[model samples]
Target: MKSYRIIKSPTEGFYKEKGSKFLGFAYHVNSLEDVKNKIELLKKEYYDARHHCYAHLINDGNQKLIRANDDGEPNHSAGDPILGQIRSFDLTNTLVVVVRYFGGTKLGVSGLIHAYKTAAEDALSKAEIEVIQIKQSFVVEYGYEKTNDVLRIINDFGVEINNQEFLAACTLFGRIEPEKYEALKDKLNLVHVKVSKT
Candidate 1:
């Protein structure tokens, strides 16, 4: 419940109908800016393509921001279908783009939807899906003598350390699931570790 799935790496897919070629791309995006950058890169790469339709979901496991663009395609023919595939896969923080290279033949609304859907599905199928826990950063500070106790407690809670300094005082920057934050506080209290949200 405190986790979500996203693509681990960028991937590509292809679908063809009549003479038209559909090239699909998948990526894991971290923010709205990331989504824009990716789409801009693709548009630059396929500047001459007929249309570049895309769908994206940003901020996985938190506030979800989603968008679908049909570009020049007919209404609901391209973007919606691609979005449907992303939803079907239960993916978050992901973006799927399909570049269209017109082939002499025209794909009606139905045909376009099918083509876009299949292309998006192909790209997703090729990607490696990874699950990430929804977590928040916390700073834990403790005295030198309580280092062992603090380490043991954090380790027991599966908190991932991001930074640490063992000077006169021991300070650790880490990420832990929000659901476990309260329990972590309780356990760390016993060890006298000072913990605060980052």
Candidate 2:
């Protein structure tokens, strides 16, 4: 199964309202509670906006669920379109909130749909998306002289150095791809480094 990553935070905005044209941002979120919390915060941030709508998808390995709300717009115009965007992107464990400041003009159902979709696409364009994976942590110990070489090897293996302790001997606490455990162990063997699974 595929895993997903959430956007870090603070990347959100709205477009100018053109005769009630849709303007909003889509955000990636980690949990259902986080989604609700973000919506509440945005509500306070845009307190005067006419509507604040949202949608979210949460997926675990075997089961998936979705939730959405129109916030004040017509029953299906705002929220459904935003949810559709989530589905279209094949995203999970994410949330998107669209805040609208009415422009003294009304956009019909179709117009509302287009606006929401465009808003989501615009936000997604500016987002940096990544694939999430399960990883394992390890501790690597080697001679001080091999520090640079060990770093190079770790980078080549697509692992991350979580922490480093510098003593007479350099010790690295790191994380590596779970699936590449054997390969990483073999590579460390060539450098005479000791790797302990954490």
Candidate 3:
């Protein structure tokens, strides 16, 4: 995907039904490490919780990795509904975890699903959602004579230049959206400039 929505920061909300309480957390995550770290932190924070159901969507350049765990709840009752909320928002690179306090009442499967769904929805509703473009990094090398052409390409493609050098041969380090990276790489190749992924 060229772009996707994600929460701007960590957020949380709560729901209660039949004396059972669900505490939902939403966090912006970009890697498996982030997912693991957040889960670990929550587990320590809610050590007495009966369950810690969670769902995560991580986009790593070429593909999306998803994880949903019921954490002892009935199959598809907790995790799946939380994941459904993420999907309903068309979001990626996010994680939602629901920590349950038994409250001495066992919610049936349907009730559990509704509680988890509402908890996730409430957390997301409090989040600041923003659309972000997928980016790719590249290093471009060209002769000094082609400086203007290289600058033109950067300007035209909206490439973000991170570093550059001016010498007999010039080097530019930059990043751009994937689509623009492909098109700019092709055009730069025609000018005898070298472009490689970073």
Candidate 4:
């Protein structure tokens, strides 16, 4: 299990160099679907922009996903700096997209890198950052006779109950911080409770 920082809300920032304007947007994202949705929305909202360079940092439970697209700019000049800013903040599960509007003047590679980096940094500076525990889901099943014990364990570990079914055997679908999962599972096993990963 690991803890990482993420933006709490959307934020925007702007930077200009030699008449070229870079508008940066930062978002808290949990999945690739969220990334796609925001990218589509931004493209539509800023249709007149010349370039839509972007970067993402996602730390899923099993792996960390990171990518940056330079769009049409010089290779590594746009997206790399944006990704650098994200790493500088030690943040994950976040995306930063920079929309470039040509102002009839061109900024060379160094200038473009500085502009994109500044814009991304400024956007992140305006964001509300939060640290969250990585969690995993599990489905626990036990007879009604052990219902009280199960509830006690759930409450004690502050597990998040996603769903529950009270049938022949009470089944609880929940998520718990990874650090606590093994210990909790062992305790439940002592009571003959079955815990399976969801």
Candidate 5:
């Protein structure tokens, strides 16, 4: 299994050019909803800012989802530059937003790009990078008679149990590398454990 890098926590960065101020925020996001919520909060906090541009990259199954928004800035000026910083850092499941407070100055396209890029770069540079394995979650259910056998198979296959119930019918919520899932499923099926990906 391959590992990917992401920020451990949210971070902020700043840049000022030609009297205009740029505030940057970087976050480790899990889904599209997370990105939208963060942007909404920032918009409310920086209500008077002239623009709120953003970019995000998400790992969804075998595909990488990416989006960038200029928020009325000249096309490709703000958003793409911010996304470029994300790409340079080789990070996934991350979102970067840059808010601009225009200070009666019109930063030409080049200037805007530099400002956004620098702000995003600063934010990412301040983040604590973390590496994580790609994992898939699954649920396993089995009768009490096969509880030990099912649990042993999961344990031997390196599945991390996140939750469990020890009732008459056993249930376990676990996560493991996707590559090992098929093998694990086969082993569990032998003992009549019902397994399904979550």
Candidate 6:
């Protein structure tokens, strides 16, 4: 199985039709439940909007699932297009909501589709995406004198420090990238340090 990182921040866009306002919102979420919660929050925030259509794609490394709602748009005009945009980007753990204010002028079926697609694209463009990895944890210990050097080396190596605790003479913490265990051991050994798998 393969894993990838999700978007780092929420994205939003606003568009207008005739005299009506539409707001498109996108969020990178971790789970289906989180997506639902976000949608509810948006609904509350924009209580007067005429419609709140939404879609989401949830990926758990091995499999992916999609869910969406049209709110009150004409059948497939709103939700499906938003969902298609998510799929087109190969994105996961993401949800998008397009809020329409009726605009007084009804955008025909084709116009509505275009509007929804453009809204999704605009929101996606503002998002910052990142890649994340699942890794094991380890604890490395060293004398006080070597602490600074170890910290620098860990930072330079791009390893994540999960937690750190201090004892009388040394620092202990958890780290990731199990494959780098041997390499880290070598670096510590050169500095007269020791590592314990946690």
TM-score rank order: 3, 1, 4, 5, 6, 2
Q: Over the stretch 1-198, how does candidate 6's per-residue lDDT look in tens digits?
A: 234646789999777767767789989987878987998898899999888998889876567868878887888998999999887776778998998888788888888888887788788778888876666577777777788888877786677777776665676676667677788778877878778776
Cα lDDT tens digits for candidate 3, 4-79: 8999999998999988899999999989999999999999999999999999998877788998999999999999
lDDT of 4 by residue, 1-198 (tens): 467899999999999887888999999988888889999999999999999999999976768889999999999999999999999998999999999999888788998999999999999999999988767899999998899999998889999999999888899999998888999999889889999888
lDDT of 2 by residue, 156-179 (tens): 898887899888898999887777
- Stretches of candidate 4 above 4 Å error? 60-62
Worst 10 residues of 1 by lDDT: 57-66
Clash tally, candidates in order: 0, 0, 0, 0, 0, 1
Better of 5 and 6 by lDDT: 5
Of models 1 and 2, which has the larger lDDT?
1
lDDT of each: 0.92, 0.77, 0.93, 0.92, 0.94, 0.80
Model 2 worst lDDT window (10 residues): 8-17
Poorest stretch of ten by lDDT in candidate 5: 59-68
Comparing 3 and 6 by TM-score, which wins?
3
Clashing pairs in 5: none
Q: How close is candidate 2 to the true structure, as a TM-score?
A: 0.63
Q: What is the lDDT of residue 158 in candidate 2?
A: 86
Residue 100 displacement in candidate 3 (angstroms): 0.6
State how far residue 8 of model 4 sits from its true place (Å): 2.3
Find the candidate with the highest TM-score and give its number: 3
lDDT of 4 at 99: 96
TM-score per candidate:
0.90, 0.63, 0.91, 0.86, 0.81, 0.67
- Candidate 5 lDDT, 82-164, residue by residue in tens: 99999899999999999999989899999999999999999999999999987889999888888879877987998889999
